[model samples]
Target: MKKKTLLEELRSGTAPPFIRELAGEENMDPADLVDAMLRGEVVVPYNLCRKISRPCAIGAGTRVKVNANIGTSSDYTGIEEELAKLRAAVEAGADTVMDLSTGGPLDRVREAIVAKSPLPVGSVPIYQAAVRAQEEKGSIVDMTAEDMFRAIEDHCASGVDFITVHCGVTTRVLEALKNNPRVADIVSRGGAFLAGWIIHNGEENPLYENFDRLLEIARRYEVTLSLGDGLRPGCIEDASDAAQVAELVELGRLVKRCREAGVQCMVEGPGHVPLHEVEANVR
Candidate 1:
């Protein structure tokens, strides 16, 4: 029999040990924490693959959390440098750390991060997928759907506690972008790869098309799904545009699917906006 996911167990009225500990850390009643989780107002991003010593909670009734990103880019792929940043994140009281390495020694870098990070770890696995496609297949647009899913699963098995997925960049959303152009069309790297792939292949986003497969992989590790809004505003002029709202609609649908699949998920949002639009964007 398959193991019950954290969400499924929560649905069965069980508060897992980690949740209890996190509640105490937040000085919140465990029952209240569990209640908030059930209400889809809180998340504890922990992967079963690794036991985190510095796990923390996010969302309603908990202190605001910050995640530090450390990784090696193609131009500067230094493992030691990344480790230094990891140390800094730990010392500076980061709630979590994400390894966004997009260079060689990818395996080693991620392994080192998971090995050393006491806090929960996250990643944007598609960066590796896009990198692999660019290196091996000659173009990021040439990467197969299988390649993306494989990257996601590899990261999950490697102990990534959570991951950002750009599944909301759909064909319809692309069309919306064409209809209403922006100063910055797509500023997110993962989003750009996916948008390019969709245009080149004339197909739907593989991530959105095969979300169930992604969910199964996430369920195995109990990885939290950070549903990324790929078409979020990249400038003040693009704020609340049709493309942005269209992508949000797609993401909202996926959140329901994640709930049905018993996967813990969070929604990412607005990128850049005018000062007066900040509250509106958040709302």
Candidate 2:
């Protein structure tokens, strides 16, 4: 029999130990926190595979959390440097850290970071899939859906606390982008990868199509899914465009799926926003 997750505990009207601690940290009643979590208004992004000593909650009534992105690029693949950044980010009060490395022994780097990070660790597996495609198959477009799913599974098995998946970038969202063009078509890397793959393959986004497989992997490891904002506005002018809204609608549906699957999730938003638009974006 599978063990009940933190979410399952809440669903059963009980607060997990970590939730109790987090509620106390937030000065919120544990029952209130559990209720908010049940309503999909809050997320506790911790993985059962990796026992997080420094657990924290994100979403309603929690302090504004900070997640520092640290990783090696293809151009500058320094594992040590990335580690230094991870240390600095944690020291500087980053609530979490994401490993977005696209270069130099990616697996080794990820393992090192996960081993060292006291805070929750997140990743974008699509980056690894794309990079592997480029290295092995000679093109990013050559990567198969299997490749992508395999990468996601690998990350989960590696005890990645959470992952960003661009499951909202669907064929319909692509059409929306075509019908209502923006200054920047798609600014997110994972979004671009899926968009390009969909265009090349003449199919729906694999992440969207195979979301159940994703849910299965996440459920096994208790990995939180950070549904990537593939159609996120790149520029101030592109904010709140139809394509963006379309993807957001898709994400809303995915959120419901996550909740039903008893998998934790949070939505990632636009890369850039104007000062006035920040409030609207958050809303």
Candidate 3:
């Protein structure tokens, strides 16, 4: 392939075909558009391995994308049911999918979905470790740091292109949580588990303590890390509390670290933030 350029497409009168087709009009030169796409200012997120009919960009100049989460829950659904939901989300125009399956044969379910999915697949490895602990041991708090890291490695080895790590939940933040009074504290399952474990074990979160190791795994697989907001408010009242801010600050530091280490990272923000605070939360 001579590698189609924006200029060539424009010269051929087929530049930005999708955009023009949608607008029912055309104006831009193909070569100029190709130049834009080549710059990091625009991105075509489609993995060459995943054949996408309607490709999209996800960077500086692209439209904001929405991700739909679909997965099996312990009480109600199974793999087959979740797979149906995955297809439904894609059909409904979801830009991405995250398998937040905390129940029902986690590995088997993840593998089946990833193998079948044409779009990128994401996951939270902590959920798998917690589930495994409950099944194999007695409690999530009993899960070893090694157990958690192993699960992360397993997910990467299985071809998960992205992962959410609640590395912001540090021992100091957990201590702050004990002192802070809020309406709904620690809403994230992974966060709650790590908080409980830290309180019980009287140690720092392994994810935070061993972030370099986590980065190593991610760098090896080129997996993007969605740094989870473990202390994200569960209710409007708890929004942007001390614990939350503390975690956010820690995540910012980690983000820089990941960037320095050549690993991709994005911070996950609040869960129950008020509508008014959304912009500030993003900023």
Candidate 4:
């Protein structure tokens, strides 16, 4: 039989020690934390494979988390510099760290960061997939769905506690962007990769179309899914537009599915809104 996910354990009254510890950190009762987890209001991102030295709980009734992104770019690629950034983030009291390295032996960089990070390590698996496609097939659009899923599995197996997946970048959302253009359209790297793949292939976003497969792999590692807003505005001018909201609407739908699967999930969106629009947007 397969092992139970943190969600299942919470339901069974057998949540892990780290999860219980998270409640104490939040100044919440263990039962209360369990209740929040059941209600999908709280998420403790703890992967079974990698024991997090500094575990964290994100969501309602908890402190706002700071997830610092540390990684190498195509121009600047090295493990030591990235590791120094990791140390800096931890020292600065970051709640989590995401390895967004798009350069220098992606696998090695990710694995090294995971081994060294005390905070829960997160990553954008699509980066490696897109990079691999560009190197091997000469274009990001050449990356197969199998290659994409494989990268996700590899990251989870490497003990990444969470991942940012741009599942909300759908063909419809892309269409919305076409109808309603932005001054700085699709600034997110992962988001742009998926968008390009969808338009070039004339197919649906694989992440959205094959979310179940992604969920299964996530369940196996018990990694939290950060459902990213692919069409999130890049500037104040593009803020809160129809294209952005359309992606959020799709993400809201996916959030329900994530909960139903007993997989911990977070919705990352609606950023870059105007100061005045923030109030209404949050409302």
**Which candidate leads in TM-score?**
1
Displacement of the residue 14 alpha carbon in candidate 2, Å: 3.0
Give candidates' CA RMSD values in order.
1.2, 1.4, 6.6, 1.4
TM-score of 1: 0.97
Question: For candidate 1, what's the RMSD?
Answer: 1.2
lDDT of 3 by residue, 206-237 (tens): 99999999987876665778889999998888
TM-score of each: 0.97, 0.96, 0.81, 0.96
Off by over 4 Å in 1: 275-283
Residue 203, candidate 4: Cα error in Å is 0.6
Candidate 4 TM-score to native: 0.96
Q: Could you tell me the lDDT of residue 48 within candidate 2?
A: 75
Q: Which predicted model would earn the best lDDT?
A: 1
lDDT per residue (tens digit) for residues 1-283 in model 1 = 8999988899898877878888998999999998888777788888988889988888889999999999998898888889999999999999999999999789789989998999989999999999999899899999999999999988999999999999999999999999998998899888998999999999999999999998999899999999987988888889989998899889988988998898989888778877787676554
Model 2 vs truth, CA RMSD: 1.4
Off by over 4 Å in 4: 279-283
In terms of lDDT, the poorest run of 10 residues in model 4 is 274-283
